[model samples]
Target: MQQQRSLQAFISRPLLVPALLFVLAVGLRLVYVFVTSTQNFLEGDAGRYFTMVEQLLTDQIYGYGSEKSNARVTPGFPLFAYSIYSIFPFTPNVFRWVHILIGAATVFPVYSYVSSVSRPLLGWLAGLFVAVYPPFIYMTNLFLTETLFIFLLTLFFASWQWMMNKPSVWSVILNAAVLSWAILTRPGMLPILMIAVLFLLFTRPARRLLIPYLLTVGVCFLPWTLRNWIILDEFTLLASDSGNALLSGAYPFFQENPDYKEMYSLGMSQTQYGVRVILKGFKEHFLQYLSWFSFGKLYYMFKSMWVSSTLNFPQLYMYGGVLLHYLTLLLSLISVPYLLIKKNFLAFAFTGMLLFQLLFIPTARYGAPFILLMVLLICSAAYTFWINRSRKPNYKLPAGSAS
Candidate 1:
């Protein structure tokens, strides 16, 4: 009864708004998961990812090169997929189920961290936002490494901040591991390179803390990098996929079966031809990149974060989430000063997170939508939670307490 009473007391604390919001987030996400991922596993990236993992285990093929019969993601997804696959060998659907569970579980850490910054209600609101967002929910059904990578990224970031506030070697090591794992899964982080490392090294009074973090993550990456070098022959730091993706995104000719007005290479399929033509096309289309990074593009990209994929397609309509995104971004903007003045470095760190996504995978595919949506979700939750506290009236003064 004592522990139960204590728990109830904790729950009843004035900030239970976040708690309620968290539950709502979970409920929304659960509905999404059931709608999308359950019993229906089909083609596209999700199927490709699951099959790639099955290939890794059944055949010795590490890199699923585009040789008419294979597919490729960064090594991280397939390797992690294999781990998930081993547990439920009978069905790829099992991993799909696991993806939904893991993706749904992301709400907790996301809520807790954002909640820590402001209120538990804010955390819950953030969680609720994530719970319902389609980009997150859509990805949950596939075997993408992004699912695990993001969850750990959120977890490590929260823990890293907690450790920085409190200071501990274990926290440092865990942060390093999480980030390194993120890098290993998707080498796009290789572009951002050492932001996290530099943060650990030079940001603190206890400069000694940097040693364990760098050393731990370094130890982890050494073998991984060495293995890459041995296999891919170049100074392969992480994966061998980005070159192909960049080629595909930069030029329209790289589509699955091009117009064939211009053949870039002989004996190469449409995909391979695109990858081969990427460099030349980039040189020719250099102006397109400038347009991509322009103020207009950035604004549109940021705005797109809140809008539904359905908006682009016109077949599916759900605009309520879009309204929620607008509110979210406004609140997040409000919190910017708080994060800066209050020494919430995660706010700044998250800027780098956005930048990392921007610099590498600027495409509007599954990767690009994540950035704006995340901001919108976090901000909207803050606004909703904030309004409830400020505007809502309560008259529950205790026995001896004065209003």
Candidate 2:
């Protein structure tokens, strides 16, 4: 009895929950990385990032070696990978290990932020979910930006909430800095940032902070913009791949329309081509476009069980992970209405994120970025259910008191 009580007391320490979760998160990711490292060496975007790092270290040049330097791909991941390679004896395995550590450390920000606003139990639940989440663990082994981007985004949201509560210029700058790093890692965050600024603009009390916040964000992106201008001779803010992403989205239309080939033959830029195809698809094949956007893209975004050529894991694990993801998703839906009614900013931010990402090409990998938010919603739902269940029914005592 004493031992059990001691164990409970230790676990109840303020820092213990996140600390334990971090250890578990690291252990899980490290094991995954160890297993997959033997089977897969950098492939797909992983290969490109690895090669870019190699080229940067040896040749002192950036970008995929075949082409001249351009803003076609964002430099954040390549730069990150190169920095790791610079410190350690360069190997693909080294990069994976570093990311494993990063992926594990994410638990701190996630748990700390949620615990501040909600019950400690719910906060631990959110952190634990993130620590063991299969998609997040799987991505840590890859060379992709998902791992780093998610970590930064978690920090960004946490800082954002803190700033809103405190309303200090220092907090605003800190939030903007984290957000800028997130955008650097993945331009997908650009839309989410716009949504946040819009939120500030419409809220009467927050309107005063909006201008400074926007300016700080803009200033953060200036260095990258200048780099792109110098190298690519273009005034690109993010990457030059937005058009490619749009083209990927309009793939069905491209297959059906013969005129797309003719349109492509014109000397228009990729962004222009992408826009023209989307407009044409909407005008000519509205039904197909609607179906593709609604069902096809949504399926891609939410799919959790699909196999990747890159990672070699058992089929059973994939299916199990998918089942868990679906259950959490359902629970999240149940809780969202309640959150909105309560004006929870986190839930609002999450909804905005989904809507923004939906506008672009939707992929499970892209959706992985929001898995932390999904966990929070699930925990919220469960907490609400438990609170409702545990409430005692009240009985009338007015007659007895009067007597």
Candidate 3:
């Protein structure tokens, strides 16, 4: 058929080999690092995360000796760390390796996601972007839950697409599992699951499947809530730290250089102090929330560009990289209209989720949802250009004759 020949020509183009090489080059660079950087400990988050897990196993409390309730942080990640600490190697070195190993699962899902949209090849770029992405690797090596979150989220995302293609009980159950797990990791994720469920309710095929989806999600959360209530003397659903998050986001406005440590020195318990800050922001500094939507996310995403540069080091090259990162992100924002016109519902929804999190907490870490926004946009551009080139007729050739 004409379509089959066209598809073949697209795949066999002169640049196909180079594009494949670019992806492989990126993967090999990231994959071989475990052997190369054997001594590099987790650069961030991994330290605090593992320490919390250590407390859970030995101190019989999540925070161990610290007066601060670990519940102020999300619980799912520490629980995962402890689970791994119990059965697997307890050394930080082994933990780093484990995180790296587990992160490998992201490759397949990222590939499948791009394939679902239009082309399987685009998935390579997306997945490779995640692998070499420095923050993700750093998060994994330490005690953070981003990798597990990504893995779980990819399943939920893929399931969402699958259900769109063919609504079935199996897809609903799969989505529920992924959603519940994602919720456990990032509290913000509960909203995302709600959106997905709502999407199902509104869609033609999934509307009938809402009840079963709800029941499955309920089953997942009940056990965790019950455990917390029995052991922690709280009727907490997952963790008891929303008050602290609210405070952390708000307290910076009351002072020039507000620090979490200052709250402790001032004798405010973590949860108590944090709650007051959140309330204070709402009552007095409500404008910060709106300001953050426009500038805070822009600033944080601006900073996230540079993996090495900081206000501390300020290396010229690193600073340059940092600026480049946000510049690309800004381009992504402009392309939103183009994507929307193309009916890229999945990318739009994903960006919407990030937008929600940014509204509440606009930090570089919180901006993780925009993982490959720039890369995908550029790759899609390349593919579009290639397809256009492939469609051009040979004007110099004889009419009605093949080139």
Candidate maximizing lDDT: 2
TM per prediction:
0.72, 0.87, 0.72
User: lDDT by residue for model 3 over 1-403, one digit each (tens)?
Assistant: 9999998887766445335544553454355344333323545556666666776787767662254454456556777778778897678766666666667666666666555654666766566666655555445544467668877777677677786787788888887877887888887676676666667767776688889889998998887777667766677776665654445555342244346687878888656775566566667877875565556655664456423323322256345545556655766765565665554545556656766565343566666545554555544544555676789986586688876
RMSD per prediction, one decimal? 7.9, 3.4, 7.0
User: Which of candidates 1 and 3 is the stronger one according to lDDT?
Assistant: 3
- Give the local distance difference test score of model 3: 0.62
Q: Write one digit per residue (lDDT tens) for candidate 1, span 223-253.
A: 7567656765556555545545443344442
lDDT of 2 by residue, 1-403 (tens): 9999998898789889889899999988877778654435476877887777888899877766343576777766778777888899888778778888889888877876776666787788778877876778878877878889888888887787788888889988998888888888888777678778877888898888888898898888888898878877889887877776766676552354334566557977667876787787779989888777676677777866323643455667666677778877777777777777666666777777776666677777887767677777656556666766689677777865964
Error of 1 at 13 (Å): 7.5
List the global CA lDDT of all models.
0.58, 0.76, 0.62
